[model samples]
Target: MTYESSASAFRHLLEARRSIRSFLPTRVPDSMIASVLQDAQCAPSNCNTQPWHVHVVSGSSRDRLSQALLAAEAAGRMSLDFSFSANDVHGIYGERLREQGAAYYQALGISREALAERRAASLRNLEFFGAPHAAFLFMPVFGDAVRVAGDIGMYGQTFLLSLAAHGLGGVPQTVLGMYADTIREELGVDPSLKLLFGISFGYPDATSAAAAYRIEKVPFEDSVVFHN
Candidate 1:
């Protein structure tokens, strides 16, 4: 393909990719999963440290982790490797978060006033929204997690894009990282490795409410500046 065509193809995939919250129960072919993993390995990291340590779980292991996550949520168990509080974020970032939440809840047919329903719907993250697999990304702390997290985020974007290229989709669940100790113990991960986040992946169920809507993004002109 010519350079322009190649760039267009990549842009198409990039723009088409979205967080897929509802998935068909069918497992992705092992070969396809392997190919996607290989593609994600190409993501660049600081000084090529390649700090990502990924664990993909399927079938019985997936179910076990889901159960463990739900139980932990019920028991108010939380062990975070990094700190995050919605209240700490404000202005444009917080507004964007609220907007996203509103759009998602609306798509799910839950009214803004339905707090209980929203909470229940949020629990679906633990269930992987019926996905057949989940991948947990972990990393070691070096100095601090900010830079490490940026690398992991890039890795996650590559993984998501690769899944899209392979006719699959995934939702990156920050909620999963809330139960760091639970996940580590359940998956036999070393204590030294801290959980970053997880991606639940499979064929997206187009008919599901989760796929019913996608919100518009801020226009380029509103967020970008040209300095010449």
Candidate 2:
């Protein structure tokens, strides 16, 4: 493709990509999954360490992992390699987070006061929102938080974009990392590997309520810096 055409296609792809929360039960083909992973492998990493270690679960394995995750959540069992503070999400970031939550709940017809409903909805993350497959992303710590996290972030974006390119959809769920101990035990993963997140992927259920919602992005001017 020519330069202009290439840029336009890329822009269109980026604009069209969205987090699909609900998916059809139909399984994605193994060949397609392999192809997507191949594309994701091209993602650049700091010093080419290429530290991402992924575990893709499907069929019975997916079901069992979901059940374990749900049980862990219900029992208040959480083991996180990374710390997250609610206090850090203050000011503008917090407002945007709240706004996104409101939009998502509204689209799903969930009431803010319905604690049970909220919990049920949140539990869907463990179920991979009915998707046929889930991939757990893990990486070994390099002692440098910024570089390690940055590599994983690039890898994740590449993986998601590859799914989109293949006419599939995916949603990244950090909540899955909360049950790291359960996941490690169940999947036979090394405890030394830190769980970054999980992604659920498959053909999207476009008719679902959650699929109809799209969070708006801030203006380019607000995020970009044009330095002379």
Candidate 3:
């Protein structure tokens, strides 16, 4: 393909990609999953450390991990490798978060006043929203937050884009990282490897209401600073 054609195709792919909340129960082939991971391996990292340690789970293992996570949530036992606070998500970021939540809940037909229902809905993360597979991303601390997290973020974006290119869909759930201890115990991962997040992936359920929701991006000028 010509450079212009390739650029246009890439732009289209970026526009088409979105977080898929509901997935069909059908499993993605192992070969395809391997291919996507291989593509994501090309993501650039500081000093070429390639610090990502990914664990992909499926079938019985996936189910067991989900159960453990749900049990931890029920028991109020959250052991996070990294702290998260709702108060930290304020200002324009908070507004964007609220808007996204409103759209998502509305699409799922969840009532804003129904606290129990909302909690139940959130529990679907544990089930991977019916996905047949999931991948938990882990990384070791590299002495600085910027280098470690920036590398993982790029790796994750490449993975997601690779999925999109293959006509698969996935959702990155930070909430899954809250049960870090449970996940490490279930997966038999080394305690030193910190959990970054989990991605649930498969063929998307097109008819699901959650799959229909889309949030608009802020204007480019609002986020970019141009200097001539």
Model 3 Cα lDDT, one tens digit per residue, 19-108: 999999999999999999999999999899999999999999999988999999999999999888766999999999899999999998
lDDT at 133 for candidate 1?
A: 94
Displacement of residue 188 (Cα, Å) in model 3 is 0.7
Can you write out model 1's per-residue Cα lDDT over 7-44, one digit (the tens) per residue? 99999998789999999999999999999999999999
lDDT of 2 at 220: 89
Q: Compared with the true structure, what per-residue lDDT tens digits does model 2 show for residues 37-148?
A: 9999999998899999999999999999999988898899999888775568999999998898899999999999999999899889989999999999999987756688
lDDT, candidates in the order shown? 0.92, 0.92, 0.93
**Candidate 2 stretches greater than 4 Å from native:** none
Task: Report clash pairs, candidate 3.
Answer: none
Off by more than 4 A, model 3: none
